[model samples]
Every structure is written in C-alpha cells, then in structure tokens.
Target: MQVLNKVTVAVKGMVQTIKYPVVWKPSLYMFLSLALSISTHEGQFYWYTNKEPPNPGFSQEFVGMVHAVGAVASMVGVLIYHKNLKDYPFRSILFFAQLLHGASGLLDLTFVLRWNLALGVPDAVFVTLEECVSRVVGRVRLMPMMVLSTKLCPPGAEGTFFALLMCIDSLGMLVAKTGGAFVLRALHVTRTDFSNLWLAVLLRNLLRLSALGAIFLVPTADQTDVLLPQDLLSSGSPAAAAGDEEERLLQLGKLTSHTDDDV
Candidate 1:
C-alpha cells in the first residue's frame, strides 16, 4: 500500500511535469512521428518474403548482408548527424529528415515497381542499396529527438528521465510496427499476394510527409533561452532522495525500538 501510494505520487508528479507545453509538445511529436514512420513497411516485407512467379527472390545470404550493411549505415547516419547537422536548428533538420525520408520511401516504390530491373540494376545490388539508405535516413531522423531528450531532462533526474524517453521510443516503435501490419492487412498484402504493395509504399510516404503538420510541436528556440524556465534549470525534483531519507529514518526508528525490547 505504501509503495503504491508512492508510485501514485511519482506518476502524478510526472503528469505535472509533462503539462508544460515545452515538454509535452515535442514528446508527442516524436512519438507520433516514430509511430507513423513504420506503418508502410509491411507491404515491402510481404513482397520480399512472398516473392512468387513474377517477382524476384532475395537469397538468405543476401538478406543477411543487407541487414549487416544497414547496421553500419545507421552508425554512419548518427556520426554524420552529430558531426555536421547537430548545430542546425531542430526544425530545419526535422524538415529535411521528413523530406529525405519521403524521398527514401521512393526507393521502396521503385523496388516494388521493379523499376530497378528496368533500369538494368540487379535485384541484389538495388535492394541492399535501398536497405542501407532507409536505415541511414531512419537513424538520422531519430537523432535530433535524442538530443532534445537530454535538453528536456530536469536538473536532477536526468538518467531516469532519459530512460523514460527511451521507453516512449520503444512504445512508438511497437505502435509503428503494429500499425504497419494493419496497413498490410488492409491492403490484402499476403505472403503470396503483394499486388497492392505499391499503394502501401505510397501510403507510407504520405504518412512520412504528414508528420510535417506536427513539426510545430517542436520548440524553435534554444532550451537555454525560454524552452526551460529558470527555476527548472536551477533544481530538479528530489523525490527519490526524500523517499530514501524517509525510509532510512523509519528503519532507524524500528531498530531502536527492537534494541529497547532486547534490553
């Protein structure tokens, strides 16, 4: 009961913290964008796994190669963002991320349309390139939100707050994947049927572009300016420390009472 009450207070405190527009706006924007970014991928995966008569098949080794290259590409994306794009305004970077992500979404369309084959590109080569580009763009899109997460952390609870932000990211990813699966199902994309995959690709790109509407949620000004109030910068919530102190005192009182009983 005591622990439950404490948890309720902590949750309420967190609710109070997020009530600030500066806090909630950007968080919501990140969550929605992350969630929506993945909604169009199921069709592509269906086409890949279910490539039948007319469609080309990707070899298992090549698929593994694509995954490996994608991991490296993600690292490169983060490095490039931190090195070159970190100083740019958050809105500008995100605007370009949306545009670039939309453009990358085109590669999916090209693959689905077999335009690469028409253009004399081998399926193996083209798909790997597409995977690398997609991973890089996705990682780049996520970087600014990560940087913002740190800036939003209150003075004292930085680690816990950042972990909470990561949990939000995970939740967004879950929603994105689930939403993507639903889109695939709605389009009747199956292991053996991917006739409508191009539509899914188009929908994904549209969704990526749609996030532009929420760009206003992110703060345009620097956190040092007005994003965080002076009081917030000065101190953080000491709830954990206070709880520890109270628990210590209670334990000490109990120990003293036990000693008296022993006497």
Candidate 2:
C-alpha cells in the first residue's frame, strides 16, 4: 500500500509536469525525437559483422576500434559543451545541434551505401571518423536538454523532480526502441539480409531533421523565467503556491496530512 501510494503521487506529479506548458512540448520533443532518431541504428551492430558487399560489414576488431574512438569523442563533446556552449540559450544551442545531428546521419548513409569506399576512403578510416563525429554531435545535442531539465526543478524537491525527468527520458527511449523495431520489421532488415539497411538509415536521418520543426516549443528565456514565470513570481502568488505545495507535500506524507500543524 505504501509503494502504491508513492507510485500514485509520482504519476500525479508526472501528469502535472506534462501539463505545465513551460516544460511540456519542448521536453517531449527533445527526449522523444533524439532517442527515436538514434534508435534508427538499431541492429546495425549486427549488420556490421555480416560479410556482404555494398551491404558489407566490418570486422569485429575494426568495429571495436570504431566504438572506442566514438566513446572518446563523446567525452570530448562534453568538454566542448561545458567550455563553449554552456552559456548559450537552449533554443539556439538545440537548433544548431539538431542540424548537426541530422547532418551527421549522412555519414551513416555514406557508410551503408559504401560511398566512402567509392571515394577512395578506407573503411577503417571512414567508419572511425563517422563514429567520432556522430558521438560528438549527439553529445552536443543532448547536453542542453540535461541543463534545461535541471533548471526546471522546483526548489527543495529537486531530487524528486529530476527523478521524474529521468523517468520521462526513459519513457522516450522505450518508445524509440519500439518504433525502431517496428521499422526494422517492416523493412525486413534481418541480421542475415541487410540490403535494405540503407533505407532505414535514410528514414532515420529524415526523422532527425524533423526534430527541428518542434523547436518552437522550447522556451527562449532565462532560467528564472522558466522555473517560476513572471506571473507566478507576482506579489499575490507566493502564499497560494506555498500553500498548494505544502498541502501536496502533506498528502505525500512528507509533512504527514494526519499531523497537527501547531505541534
């Protein structure tokens, strides 16, 4: 019963959070689109081991090297975001990042179609470069989202709110993976037959580009404007917000609704 009550409160908070316009659509777009876009590469790992042409695969060792390079590139991306893009507005940072994110998908396409080989680039060199760029762009695309989510947390309950944010992100990942599975099934992209894998890559790139359309949902303001809007900060709002929050806390048993206030 205690677990049930906590789940109920969490669900209620999630609903309230989603309904809150200052955070809803932007959060939805950011989390869902990025995850879904990445999921397009699902099963590609196995495809990399298949020994076929035009749809040919890389050796295990080469793939491992590519992954290592990509992992290092991801760390580099974090440093770049911290040092360079940390001060930028969420909208501006997301705009360029999404653009770069979508563009980076082209490297996937290039690999899938063996265009890199046609252009005289060795597979090892090309794949490593592609992996590195993708990781960096992905990190850049995601950092602003993490920063924004943190800023949206309410005072004194940041841990709770951040956990909810993580749940929301996890939900997006679930949906994306499910969607990618369906797409792969529909395209008949099996481990043994990856001829249609290029199509999947193309479609994924398009979806990544589409994330830009939803950018308008993101707020273009300071953290203060986002956490508690101007109206909420007005003279008359504190008592109401505090009372409402206090009542909510009591119901959740943090303040214990059954307890005497005077005591």
Candidate 3:
C-alpha cells in the first residue's frame, strides 16, 4: 500500500505539469481507472466473502480482468488526446465527469437493492448501498475537490501540492479501513449488523457532499494564460512598459557587439 501510494503521488505530480485541455480527457480516464479498480476489488471481496466455502475465487479473477481492461482504455485515451492538450481545461472536464459519476453511484443503489431482494435479504441491501454510496461520495466527489485544491497553489508548487493531495487520500484510506476493522471486531457483529450502522455512514457522506458543494460558492482562481517571451516583454509588466525603449536599445547593442566579435 505504501508503494502504491508513492507511485500514485508521482503520477499526480506528472499530471500537474501536463498542459491543459488534452490532459483533461486523459486525467478523467486515469481517475476512472482508479475508481473502477478499487470499486471492483471491494465489490468482489464482499461478494466472495458472503458466499459459501470452497469458493472458486472467480469474483477476484473477474475484477482483475476488469482492472486490466481499464488500464488499456486509459492508455488509448491518452494517445487519442495527445494532440489536443490545450483545447479544454481540467476543471471543466473534472466537474462534468464528477457530476455524471455521482449520479451513476446513486443509480446503482437501486440495482443493488434489487439484487439483495432477489437473494431474500432486502434488509442487507440498505447497508450495502450505504457503504457503496459513501465510497462513491469520497472518490467521485471529494477526490476531485482535493485535486482542485492543488490548482490554487503557485505555479512552481504544483508537484508539492499534488503530492500532498495524494498523501491525504492515502491517509484517509488507511484510517477508514483500519478503523472499520477495529469497530467490527470490537462489536463482535456479523454482516447483518451493518444495517444498524448504515444511517451513521449515510449521514457522514451527506456531510462530505455538502462540503464539496460549498466549494462552488467560492470565486474561481485567475487562469494563467501562456504567452511567448516576446509577448511577455512587450505587453506584460511595468518594467516592460517603462523600459521598453532602453531594453530594446540595449539588446540591439549586444547583438551588434556579438556580430563584430564573430567577424
């Protein structure tokens, strides 16, 4: 897990340096890759555990195949977007994708409940759905908010900003996993006990979503427009405006001196 966290942080740092628009689609694909990987793994684990002994491990193998497919898809997406990097910004794509992703999570709850009902454990469905919803709220919504927070950093600080974001996610996962295990052990409860815990978890996720929604209430940061060196020298700074005459004359004199030396 530690090694995985380091690798993810490094990738996020690299993502920070990528030019926008083209990066947007690839980043979305990357995020989906992670979400799908984690979700499928967890789903299979739960599904397998709930079954009888001598399980063939089919669910685990299936999830592994799904993750492999997601990896291939992400690679293809990157190649496809390689030429269009600056046409779309990251925030726009992230926001829209998250909205869609969140809706999908909510919609899945109905299907999950139907499956539970078919299995004659309708009560268990609520607990499973609550847990799934919490995960989706964190990954689909809060994760994007964390990424957006890094965009507020100064230009050269992008790597550090993203690294910190990754660290937070890693820590959050560790705490949630360990704490959940401890609670389950201490309570000596079976799978059915999860239903009793569903309300608390659901409320917690609601609070998390509400907090992320509040970020929209804040003002957006000023976008830094990329320009050529000549454009910067001509139009951008106070120094450029007041010393343009002297600066151009000085540059010309240096060029002439260099030419004379070359001769």
Candidate 4:
C-alpha cells in the first residue's frame, strides 16, 4: 500500500504536466482501473468463502481472469474516450463513480449481514462493478489532490511535494487497515459473522464517502486563481483562459525555481 501510494503521487504529479481536459480524462480511466483492482480482491475473497469448495485457488483464478479482462477493457476504454475527453467533467464522472462504489460496498455489507447466499452472488457482482468504476474515480480523486499539493510547494520542490503526499496517503491507509482490525478484535468479532462484518464494511464505505466529500471542498482548477487575479491577468490570454492553468503553472514553476535556487 505504501509503495502504491508513492506510485500514485508520482503519477499524479507527472500527469498534471500534460494537457488539460485530455489529462483529466485519462486520470479518470486510470482511477477506474485502480478501483476495479481493489474491489476485485475483496469480491474474489468473498466468492471463495461463499462457494462450496472454498478453494483459495479458485479465488486467485477469479482475480487473475478479471484482471486480464480489465486490462483489455481498459485499453479499449482509453481509445474510445480519447476522442471525447474534453466533453466530460472529470469531477462529475468521479463523483458518480464514487457514489456507485460506495453503494456497492454498502450492498456488500447488507448481504454479509443477512447471510443471503442468493443475494451474495449479486453483491459480489456489484463489488466487481464497483471495482471497475473505481479505476476511473480513483484517478479523479487522486490526481486533483496531487495537483493541489504540487501547487502549494516551494519552487522546484515537486519531488518533496510528491514524497509528502505519498507518505500521508500511505500512513492513512495503514491507519485505516490497522484501525479496522483493532475494532474487530476489540469487539470480539469474527469475519464469518454476518452482522459484524457488515458493520465493519459499512463503516469503511462511510469513511470513503466522507473522504470523497472532502475533496469537493477544495478549489477546482478554475477557483484556485481567485486569490490572484492580477498575477493571472499578467499571464495573457492562454493563462487567463483557465484560472487553474495559470495558478498551477505559476505555483509549480515557483516551487521548482525556488528549489533550484536553494540548491
């Protein structure tokens, strides 16, 4: 998880340097891919336990197949979206996807609580779908946050900014996982208990939803420049066209330049 967080930070910082609208689209797709990867692992595990055979191999196989299929589907999605990238707002798509993802997680919790084998299959399916959707939304959530962090750093300190983001994100993940385990243990709950597991799942989804909501409060690419209209106006038409563009460029440049000067 730590390593993955680091990679995410790196990717976000790198991708923000690319063209807008275009960069935003790919980030969504990538986020969906990430979501799929995460959701599938849990789904596969659920499937294995629910099945009569309870074979770990079957779970592994299921994950592998889904991953392979996802790879192909993602490639196709990228190609299809390439032409219409700018038509969609990345944040809008991301919010919808996250809502769906949270809904799926909630459904999973419901099925677990009820111990409905009949419902379990559908729950697993929802999880699978959420996984796919997450791939797109995850990137949406991650990239914007990274871009914001990069914007706040001193000039030429992009590496430091990225490192801090990674560290914080990884720490959050570790705390979440560990805290979850502790909660379960403290409650004397077992994974097989439908009610206990469901509660845990519900809490997890709630946390995720809250996090998503928090992202909405941050200034968008456009709103970031509200603090400095004069600086933005000085940059001319291209920079003035998108406030976010000017703010991001100036912030990043200042950070990078400052770092160079410091060195």
Give the least accurate 10-residue stretch of model 4, judged by summed lDDT.
32-41
* lDDT tens readout by residue for model 2, 160-212: 66787888788887877877888888899987878788898888888888888
Give candidates' CA RMSD values in order. 3.0, 4.6, 12.1, 11.5
Question: Taking the tens digit of each residue's C-alpha lDDT, what string does model 1 give over 1-263?
Answer: 66875666566556656677787888888888888776665456556655475576766566777899999999999998878888777778887887898889999899889999889998888988999998989888888888888877666556766777788888998998888888888888877788888888888888888888999998886423436566566555443444455578778989999999999
lDDT of 2 at 33: 64
**Could you tell me which 10 consecutive residues in candidate 1 have the lowest summed lDDT?**
235-244
150 in model 3: Cα distance from truth in Å? 6.3
Better of 2 and 4 by lDDT: 2
Best by lDDT, which number? Answer: 1
Best by TM-score: 1
Ranking by lDDT: 1, 2, 4, 3
Model 4, position 42, has a per-residue lDDT of 42
Q: Model 4 reaches what TM-score against the true structure?
A: 0.50
TM, every model: 0.87, 0.82, 0.40, 0.50
**Alpha-carbon lDDT, every model:** 0.78, 0.76, 0.41, 0.46
Q: By TM-score, how accurate is candidate 3?
A: 0.40
